[model samples]
Target: MMQATQKQDFTTTFSVDRNPREAFEAITNVRGWWSQEVEGVTDQVGGEFDHHYKDVHRCRIRVTELVPGRKVAWLVLDNFFNFIEDQAEWKGTEVVFEISEKDGGAEVRFTHVGLVPQYECYDVCTNAWNGYLGGSLRNLINTGQGQPNPKEGGNAPAHQDAATVLRARRTP
Candidate 1:
């Protein structure tokens, strides 16, 4: 059996026992599940936001698409990762969230549109996204409380799932 191997973007999906509107709202609440410091606008189209996690990873995201109860997309304008050699690996990528009605509830699909396995950040990033989407984000939609990184001094490095990435990399 010849198995075809092809690289694909990183993506994850989860179902919530809520309406599409609720799921969409939870997805827009970036500060809720992503667990970082966000500045500027996140829910408005054409808006820009910057999120940083203890100098480990920082990115400027511009909201390129916002569809109520349907979808939201953000384009990565700039990115910095202290762990990987290519600090700009996330630049020019797109973070997209799609919400659709399913089984009397809603399903949210998250896709990091250019984050292929070829990038160094793929493994660590995939783990983080899985935690964010499957655990935190899903909790927020269901219970109204997402375990976000608080502003107070706790949870060092901010990114709950990716803190080790910083210490694992060598500083040149």
Candidate 2:
């Protein structure tokens, strides 16, 4: 398995008119703004989320920590069948989003922390985060809603159908 001894982190900031609590709540409602490409519960700490990006690229994320209106973090439990096949390659890896009140608005910061920089999927994964956390987040905050699909973004490519390759995992 590949390991990144040095931590890898990417951050992007966004400002919104809503208070921190509302902004943070919208973010935690993953199914609302995120691609339906992902599914499962995310309302509280310990809930799990699954993101299916391609026929073979799938990630199982577990909500590890949460502070309402402040922060949320997820542990990558499984990343299977794509660039990185070994689950251990991503285990313990965490992605976090922190929200706080700012002048006239709320501020959001997203981080994909320590994802084994040398691994094959680093770039792609980072780009995906940009779309979800950066693009989708901005849309949700400004409009008080979210884009239903990726194609809604002029820059985004058409989404691939995943009904055949991905299905909701029975919640354990």
Candidate 3:
């Protein structure tokens, strides 16, 4: 029997007292909210950056679209999630942030394209993103400095290769 596949992407929207430009700037500052371990440029189109979350997650993303005070999009070039069955599940995803003026403030919408519910990491990833976007990122837009994840270094043991952690997951 053929079953219909459902499409589900994580999205969150909120309005802030700041202007669209401020919201845009905050979204571009990936390290400020998403991760402190980001490397490379993230503010310009075609620029690339790497985000590492301890040893559990790592991804290289390129800024594919950036419209000042309006929209920004990132293409995930490569990814590895140690806890997931498909370590490279997020490799081709797109993370998008759109900002618009509304009610004398800025309305920000964030979407993680391809992060469907069928993916193994969807629940955990979505919850983490809620804290990052709704809580941390929003705090940065309202006040200075976001509550980013602590720099706790890598989680893999010193004797093990980081890539090996992905292969060590139990088979279903």
Tell me the tens digit of each residue's lDDT in model 1 across 1-172: 1122265888888899999999989888999877558888999999999887766678899999988999999999999876788877799988888899999999998889889999988887887778778888899999998876666476643335464744555544
Q: How many clashing pairs does model 1 include? A: 0
Model 2 misplacement above 4 A: 1-6, 84-88, 148-172
lDDT of each: 0.82, 0.67, 0.80
Clashes of each: 0, 0, 0
CA shift at 159, candidate 2, in angstroms? 9.3
Predicted structure 2: clash tally: 0
Q: Would you list the rank order by TM-score, best first?
A: 1, 3, 2
Per residue, candidate 3 scores C-alpha lDDT tens digits across 41-116 of 9998999998887667889999999999999999999998877778767989898888999999899988888888
Total backbone collisions, model 3: 0
lDDT of 2 by residue, 1-172 (tens): 1233355555667788888888878888776677666688677788998876445467789998888888888888877744444546666678788888999688988776766467655555566566666566677877777764442233333222222223323123
User: What TM-score does each of the candidates earn?
Assistant: 0.89, 0.75, 0.84
As for candidate 3, its clashing pairs are none
Selected candidate, larger lDDT, 1 vs 2: 1
Number of the top candidate by lDDT? 1
